[model samples]
Target: MLRYVINRIIVALPVLFGVLVVTFFLIRLIPGDP
Candidate 1:
């Protein structure tokens, strides 16, 4: 159970980072919105 939780967290971290990066760029590209 502990190992599973750890693995999930590790996987989630990258996905979260990717989402943040995409959102950041998307916000910039749209312009006139923030």
Candidate 2:
């Protein structure tokens, strides 16, 4: 159903955001600048 798909996407959004935030922090921890 459309509702089920929407719910799944809503759940995924936060996970995706968390991954991005973690990646940013990891990159910041690196010694060298880009």
Choose the strongest candidate by lDDT: 2
| Model 2 CA deviation exceeding 4 Å by range | none
Error of 1 at 33 (Å): 4.3
Residue range 1-34, candidate 2, lDDT tens digits: 9999999999999999999999999888887766
> Model 2, poorest ten-residue lDDT window?
25-34
Q: Which residue pairs in candidate 1 have backbone atoms (N, alpha carbon, C) closer than 3 angstroms, thus clashing?
A: none
Candidate 2 lDDT at 9 equals 100
**Relative to the unseen true structure, what is the Cα RMSD of model 2?**
1.2
| Alpha carbon lDDT of each predicted model | 0.94, 0.95
- The candidate that wins on TM-score is 1
| Whole-model lDDT, model 1 | 0.94
Off by over 4 Å in 1: none
Error (Å) of candidate 1 at residue 14 is 0.4
